[model samples]
Target: MPPPALLYALAGIWISVIGLRSVLVEEHFFRKIVASNIFGSGVFLVLVALARRAPEGPPDPVPQGMVLTGIVVAVSATALMLALLGHLHDLEKPDNQEDPS
Candidate 1:
């Protein structure tokens, strides 16, 4: 039987590949943003899997810390991307105006 970590690593790699493909192939900006988030999540999962190298001992703290930090960064980046997307959407809308008589 394969170890749990190996399974997680494989899943992460698969997810990352899928996300990357979507980011490259999708035409919409929103879809690209979502794909980027998925890619980040997959990377975090891989990091977590790597951290669990020693089953007998406690998992390494460094990778765990890095993952935590990365999560925060990812969230912030996603928020920023969403805000930018919203701004772009607003800009694309046809503005309605009342002409002064």
Candidate 2:
């Protein structure tokens, strides 16, 4: 069987590439946010995979902690981006008081 690191690294590269492509191609704000989250997840996957170098030893805690922190930060940033997108959309809406004709 292939090593865990190799598998994880491949998956991370594939996922990150896909995320990057989506981010570049998509025009909508929500799609871009989702793609960025996917890219971040791939980065975390690579970090965890690096921590598993030896088969006999336990994984280090520092990288794991950083990954967890990154997750939290990514979530908060996504939420903030979504809120800003919503506000911008609301502002762009034509005022109801204006004449439709």
Candidate 3:
């Protein structure tokens, strides 16, 4: 029966640690990209949890705005990385196959 804030904070920290490990241990570019995204999400989760601590005050816009911006950036970066991976794969495929002509 931990408090909701403690639970959220712990979860965020756990996710961040996992993400950091994946980024460090994995050699693949795709895996690194995903790990980075996970790390960013963990940061957002922690921030939201902090915001919840001050329920008396009006909700803060700064944290919300930061999280929103982060999400947009992360999505864009992932899309770009995926596109690059696809292009690289396509280029490598021709080299692996024997010429049929």
Candidate 4:
């Protein structure tokens, strides 16, 4: 059987591909945002898997640290994207206020 790290890497690759495809094909901005998150998660998974490649030695700390930092950035980016989307949605709505006489 293949090593666990190999399996994780393969899964991460598959997930990244799927997410990228969705991001490219989907028209909705919300879906694209979700897909982007998936892509980021897959990248992090792959990085972690790579860091664990040397089973006999201690895992690399750099990739793990990078992944942690990336997660923080991703969350912040997602929040900003969501806020922008909300603003765009509000802007697209027709005004319902009555005109002053």
Model 1 lDDT-worst window of ten: 90-99
lDDT of 1 by residue, 1-101 (tens): 77789789889999998999999999999999999999998999999998987766898899999999999999999999999988888788747434678
Off by over 4 Å in 4: 94-101
Candidate 3 — which residues are off by over 4 angstroms? 95-101
TM-score, model 2 to reference? 0.85
Better of 1 and 3 by TM-score: 1
Cα lDDT of model 3 by residue, 1-101, tens digit: 65687689789989988999998999998889899899888988887777677646665678878888888998998899889987887887967756799
Ranking by lDDT: 4, 1, 2, 3
Tell me the spans in candidate 2 whose CA falls farther than 4 Å from its real position.
Answer: 94-101
Better of 2 and 4 by TM-score: 4
Number of backbone collisions per candidate: 0, 0, 0, 0
RMSD of each: 5.2, 4.8, 4.2, 5.2
TM-score of each: 0.89, 0.85, 0.79, 0.89
Give the per-residue lDDT digits (tens) of candidate 4, residues 15-98. Answer: 999999999999999999999999999999999999999867899999999999999999999999999998888788757435
> Model 2, 95: alpha-carbon shift in Å?
7.1
Candidate of highest lDDT: 4
